[model samples]
Target: MHEPIVEFQNVSFSYGSRVALQHVNAVINKGDYIGLIGPNGAGKTTLIRVLLGLLKPSSGNVRLYGKNIKEFKDWHKIGYVQQKATTFDATFPVTVEEVVAMGRFAFAGVGRPLDHHDRHRIGDVLKMVGLDKVADRRVGELSGGQQQKVFIARALASDPDLLILDEPTTGVDVRSQHEFYHFLHDLNVHHRLTLVLISHDTDVVSTHVSRLLCINKTIMDHGCSIEFLLPSHKHNDVKKNEQIFKRVRHKH
Candidate 1:
């Protein structure tokens, strides 16, 4: 059955005087794969931070799974693959398996070693993301696309119901990007994962996402992917290419 997984109610946020998000309201339902798009400094990342509870809304409320986000604690149910994961140092010397294993720490606390179940789960997630063969290889040694897969495997290790990704295709090759999109679609169809993906390219995601939310500090528009790119809404396109992508914060 469909249920609201994440909700924003008149949500507003500011960095002292500068506003990042204003009166944003949205209902994210189970099995809904929404593509969040916006021009530079449009608070896309800020909204994500708010949803993840990294920032508090200046007004209104945010909820996850029907509970206020501030009070919700079942973090393992929500998985995140941050944009910075691609820039991880190749010289760090950690193996792919070791990095993916980091996801287990959320369930088993720090300093605890993996038991048989944990190891098996790690292998399963690795295979799910097509990284099992390279499990023993140094993460830094893998190509950029392969490294990105490792981080995705790490996020899926928790078997989250909702998966959030920020610019997941950044730095990936064209072929790898298409593969990533297909993988996400498979996850949505087979695993019934509710996804929130932030991307700069509308054309790329228009074919895959069910919904599109266009924002510029506030929601300029939102609707089905087909309706979003219509002639009437074409003005919202910040660029035929990428915009001045920046995550602005309301700093005191």
Candidate 2:
């Protein structure tokens, strides 16, 4: 019962002289919905990149599905929606179907056309994300929120057990933000897809995630969201640390 889907053991990373992360130790168990929150310049993104194997740690190890960081493979098992997925020019010609189909290719490999099963899976994910109606439309023509939905559909095309998204609702409208979170809820609730959602929006994050990891070059605090923000005097130290989060968010 000690198995974790993802593990970071004393992980640290530096961009040359600038230290981005420091001794980050964490574990993502199966079926976890984690909200990784921190202020700007915090190591949230750095930790994410290291987890995805985009950046090698200067020290310590990261493991995916219990494999050692250096030995892990099968990256297609995890889906990632990186920063600014909707920043493309409005004239870009790729259709929504084409964008989602890219995820199929990621799983099936280069030069392999979609078979019947692959096409069905593609259609199913599009419908699940509520983008089936606009499958033929140009992805760039959609609203920022709709485009982000397409990205999620693409990420789901592979039916990954784990999904990682960075600022998925960054340019989305307020209403769309709720809708997107609803879709995420469905994924985590119905499909049991584990998630690591990285954002600076504390209000939105604290509500959705099962666990909250507060990071700032290192972890400030982490635990269940309810207890993490509770007003209990017995947990005064934890409350004070949460105050640092509030101060960081309020500092403008």
Candidate with maximal TM-score:
2
Q: What is the lDDT of residue 111 in candidate 2?
A: 98
Please give, for residues 56-160, the per-residue lDDT of candidate 2 as tens digits.
999999988889977887888799998889897778899999999999999999999999999999999999999999999999899999999899889999878
The TM-scores, one per candidate, come to 0.87, 0.87
* Candidate 1: tens digits of C-alpha lDDT, residues 1-252: 779999999999999999999999888899999888775587988999899999999998999999988789988999999876788787898999998999987767788888999999999999888998999999988887888889888888877899999888888889988888999998999988999888766667666787777766777533423333333344676553222121111100
Clashes of each: 1, 0
lDDT of each: 0.81, 0.84
Model 2 is weakest, by summed lDDT over 10 consecutive residues, at 224-233
Clashing pairs in 1: 15-250
- In model 1, state the lDDT of residue 212: 70
Model 1 TM-score relative to the real fold: 0.87
- Error of model 1, residue 159, in angstroms: 1.8
